[model samples]
Target: MKNYLNSTMIKITLMIVLCMSAFAFNDSKVSAKDEAIDLRAKAAILIDADSGKILYEKNANKAYGIASMSKMMTEYILLDKIKAGEISWDDQYNVSKYAYKISHDTELSNVALREDGVYSVKELYEAMAIYSANAATIALTEVMAGSEKNFLPLMNKKAEELGLKNYTFYNATGLNNKQLKGMQPKGTPEDGENEMPAKYVAKLAYQLVKEHPDMLETASINKKAFAKGTDDEIMMTNWNYMVKGGIYEYKGVDGLKTGSTDFAGQCVTITAKQGDLRVIAVVMDAKEENGDSTYKARFDAAKTLLDYGFNNFKMQEVMPAGYTFKNNKTIAVKDGQKKEVAIEASKAISFIANKNTTYKPKLVLDKKEITAPVKKGTVVGHVEIQGDGYGYIMPVKDQATVVTTDDVQSKGWFVKALGGIGDFFANVGHSIF
Candidate 1:
């Protein structure tokens, strides 16, 4: 009997050891996965383009030089003007001395423009979008705001209107003012360049892609000859090599922007689509293991972010339609046949998250109690999602409308009057007490 008891004890100990081993193995796997996604950039952000859910971030709020990526603001402003009928693609612009000089500077990206050349808005926009041509960008600013100096105010005003809280725009071309050869905007530092946090950069890219998807047509062009069959024609190549037929071609990568400068290093704001899943990634000032910035480092960081998003997370319905909040299923109704009315989420809320993620629904009522005679489907407030720490890229998109589940009739007039009298006496009694 003693030998049998000792054997049983030994088996139990072995079982516990095996269970502990399994748990430790699982924990190590998770830790390795978390460590594998490190980004080699000064700032980075990954967001679900469709739902505006942030997947990952690193130093996302710290401001850094954006270099040519600043042209995205120029693109947004131009697109806004075209949408409002304030300008047309056919509108013609005369190259200014600033634009003319910049175009002739061989060190910069530009299409040479003859002094007497008249160019249409479409041509210059294509040059700016496809080639990151500084001269073409400046000419468009001249067309829109009369000069790049005047366009500075427009950029800041639009940034404010778009809820971009941290940003500074010094030029339309995204060129360092020192490179402008004393032509930098008045009252601005001569060596200044455009700067913004990674979050704002992602926001600007999000707004641009959402509002003006048509811009992708120009931005996606891999290579095009400017002024074909003319003496001044030059081959304009897209700086975003991730586009189709480029060195680092990525699937579903059609539009966006790239930038590089001594101060900014290498930066890219990339967008990609797979099936119904769309994601945007921004990598700013990417560097090598040795701490030297390189063009490939930006693309590498962006690729890692994009892969992490597409592989780890998927868009799923976190909260179902008609879902009821557990703690607040019904709301009080004043003078109704029933004392309360049932409420539910009017629509489903979906977002990108991992399989292990969980969400809780929170109901926020418009008022403490709704008036009687409420109609079914009447909006009461909104249902918000409380996730497992991860927040949304756009918090407003994570809400669903909350509505009354059924109609409630008003109480009989005599009953309401009697209840009112009883309530008054009760109040008086409480006050006397």
Candidate 2:
């Protein structure tokens, strides 16, 4: 557990901050070549969850019709409320007249809410996530926040906090009735109202999966009904067809959500884990020339990126903070120091490599030398490692403890107390001589 915590890590982790410090070194821009996949979406983004690296993207930062992916924010706000004990999973939720009416009025997805039956907050999350049950989302949003009016504010605030510069929220179910001007149920966009839009709904979806991985256990289930012993009778189904059953070798495909609207076409956000590496793919507005929504394109894109990551990258846990990371001179105590003192790595560094690339990282210690009565986990030195493909920057620590170099030559704490006695003896000795 001797993990190194570096001062650099404590600072805003500018992934390329170190690289920028010395010279304007341009990274070998990878072309990201892979012709096996085609995306029909107007916008899409494939991201490496850990590094926020864009693996693939069509319009990575353009805002478009997000459709039901907006429910992910709904779920986040709901889950945040639950975690804070503002609501319980089992709290009874009766279908509000507003929720029940959406099933018949809106041209949207729903489980056909039962107005009289009670559902727990947890059941609605599954319906909203796995099934994209629009009614479930609206009801959950209203109940959790007392109204959609208040929840929408939190949604935008949270998006801004996450650095999502291009997202806004108006409704919980993602139906921009605003787009359906002069239509019956699909209301027109209000005179000045706007909707939440993100360049990559997949990025946010991936984040949710990582933050609450336990949600995957619930998300992986393809079908379910409300709590059995309760008064609910309707059954629910998953929307992601591949998650329902697929022809590909999707071994650890665990999460997330699916969405679709006439404008958004077939949208999907997929998350999977292979060992320690995780990839999330978001596809929006997917449709083909044959009038079929390109669900396979989304599926293939996810598998492609996951395969790419798993095939190329491997994680290497660096040496512990106290161990010698390289042959560089270790930081040691200076003033009264004897040989050395304790120094520990204050950070942990992991490296990612391609198949042909080797994982030989170089070391970058903070300063040239150190003197000690140094405390454990103190910042001492650093390590930087690089190969043709992947590289990592880290810190180092002294393996052992040290004391002052010369006891009499110093006036440290203990020495000061004993200095008076030594000075008196010196005077007496001089007189005798």
**RMSD, one per candidate, in order:** 4.1, 13.3
Cα lDDT tens digits, model 1, 133-222, are: 999999999999999999999999989878886788889887899999899889899999989999889988988999998888888899
> Which candidate should be chosen as best, given lDDT against the real structure?
1
Q: For candidate 2, which ten residues in a row score worst on lDDT?
A: 390-399
Total clashing pairs in model 1: 0
How many times do residue backbones clash in model 2? Answer: 41
TM-score of every candidate: 0.84, 0.65
Q: Show the colliding residue pairs in model 1.
A: none
* Candidate 2 structure quality by residue, lDDT tens digits, 104-223: 454567776676756778877888877788778877877877666666778877776555656655576777655323221222245322333334476567567656767778777777
Per candidate, the number of residue pairs that clash is 0, 41
* lDDT of the structure predicted as candidate 1: 0.87
lDDT of each: 0.87, 0.60
